[model samples]
Target: MLLLFLSVLLTLIYCSHGDLIADTCRKTQYPLICISTLRSNPHSRSADVKGLVRFILKAALGKANTILNLANDLLKKTKDPILRQSLDTCISVYQDALDEIPIAIENVGKNNVEASDNASATFVDADTCEESFSNSPFAADNKAVKQLAVVAEDIIGSLG
Candidate 1:
C-alpha cells in the first residue's frame, strides 16, 4: 500500500504543471495552440523549449522590476545635469523591459493554463509573441514616472 501511495503521489506531481498567471491568457486562443502542440508531439523537443522560454520570460520580468526601482531612485535625489541624462537613458531601457514583462508573463501563464486544461492530451505548439516582445527595444521615459508632479513639471521645463 505504501508503494502504491508513493506511485500515486509521484504521478500527481508529474501531472501538475503549476500555476497560471491570469484568467485572460488562460482563456485565449494562443494557449489553446500550446495545448495542442503539447498533446500531439509529446516526444518532440518543443516541450523543453516552451519551458525554457517561460523561465526566460520570468527572469526578464524580475530584471525589469529591479532596474525600474533603481531608475526611480536615481531620478529622485540627484540634481546633477549629466547624471540626470544618464539616468534618463537607463530609465528608458528599464521601462522598455517593464512594458514587455506583462505580456511575457501572460504567455507563460497561458501556456501552463493550456497544458493544465489538456492533461490527458499529448502536445501543443507554443506561442512566440511574448518571447518577441522580450527582445524589443527599451523605452526611457520612465524616469518621469517616478518624479513628483512639481519635479516632473520642472523637468518638462528643462526639456522645453
Candidate 2:
C-alpha cells in the first residue's frame, strides 16, 4: 500500500508538462507572463521550480542586454546634451542589470536564497533605467525590461 501511494505521488509531481507549467505559473505574480514564457521554452517541460526560476532570470538578462544596446545606439545618434546624459545613465543601469541577472541565475541553480536579492537588484536596475527614458522613444523598451526583471524577482521570491 505504501509503495502504491508513493508511485501515485511521484506521478503527480512529474505529471504532464502543461500541468507542471500551469501549476507553477499560478504561483507567480504574473501568471500570464509566467505561463507563456515557460511554455515557449522546450526545456521548461522537464524543469522543476529552480529550473523555472533560472529560465526567467536568463530571459530577463537577455532583455536587459537588448535595452542596453538600444540605449547605446540612441546615445550615439542624439545631439541633445540632456537626453545624452539620460541615455548614459540608462546604459549604466542596464549594464548593472546584465551583471546581476547572471549571478541570480547561478545562485538559484544552486538553491541559494541570495538569488532573490540579486533578482531584486536587477529589478531596481531596470526601474532606474526606465525612469531615465520616461518620455523618450526607448521608454517602451525600458518598460519591457523592467517588467521582465520584476517577473524574474517575483518568481525567485516565490521559491522561498
Candidate 3:
C-alpha cells in the first residue's frame, strides 16, 4: 500500500511538471507566430491585419525596451570588457531599429492620407490621377514601410 501511494504521488507530480513545460512552450511559440503573421501581412488593409500589425509592433517595441533594460543590468553585473561591448552594441542597434519604426509608420500614414486626398480631388470623370496615383512613388513607399516592419521583427529576434 505504501509503495502504491508513493508511485501515484510521483506520477501526479510528473504530470503536473509536464503540463507546466507544455504551457511555457506554447507561450513562446504564440509570440513567434504572431510576429511572423504580422510581418507577412503588413500591407494588408483589412481591420484584422491592421490591428495585428499594431499589436505586434507594440509588443516588439516593448520587448526591445526590456532588452535595453537587461543590457543595462548586465553592464552593472558584469566586468568582462567583451561582454560589455557586445551588450552596448546590441542596445545601440535595437535603439536604431526602434527609432526607424516611427518614421516608417509616419511616412506610410502621410502617403495614405495624401493618396486619399488626391483621389478625392479628381473630378468624377477624371481617371488619370487615380490611375497614376496607383503607380506613384507613394505606393512604392508603402511597400518599403511593410518591408521595414519585417526588418524590425528580424531585429527583435536578433536582440532576443
TM-score per candidate, in order? 0.39, 0.83, 0.41
The TM-score between candidate 2 and the true structure equals 0.83
How close is each model in CA RMSD to the real structure?
17.2, 4.4, 18.6
In order of TM-score, best first, we have 2, 3, 1
Estimate every model's Cα lDDT from 0 to 1.
0.38, 0.77, 0.42
Global lDDT of model 2: 0.77
lDDT (tens digit, per residue) of candidate 1 on 75-112: 79889676666666556655664554444435443544
lDDT of 1 at 37: 30
Cand. 3 Cα-lDDT: 0.42
* Candidate 2 deviant stretches above 4 angstroms: 1-15, 109-111
Candidate number that wins on TM-score, 1 or 3? 3
Give the per-residue lDDT digits (tens) of candidate 2, residues 1-160: 9999999988876676569678777876777877777778888878987888788777777778887898899888999998898889888988888888888888885655678788888878877776775476666666665666666667667666
lDDT, model 1, position 35: 39
In model 2, which range of ten residues has the least summed lDDT?
140-149
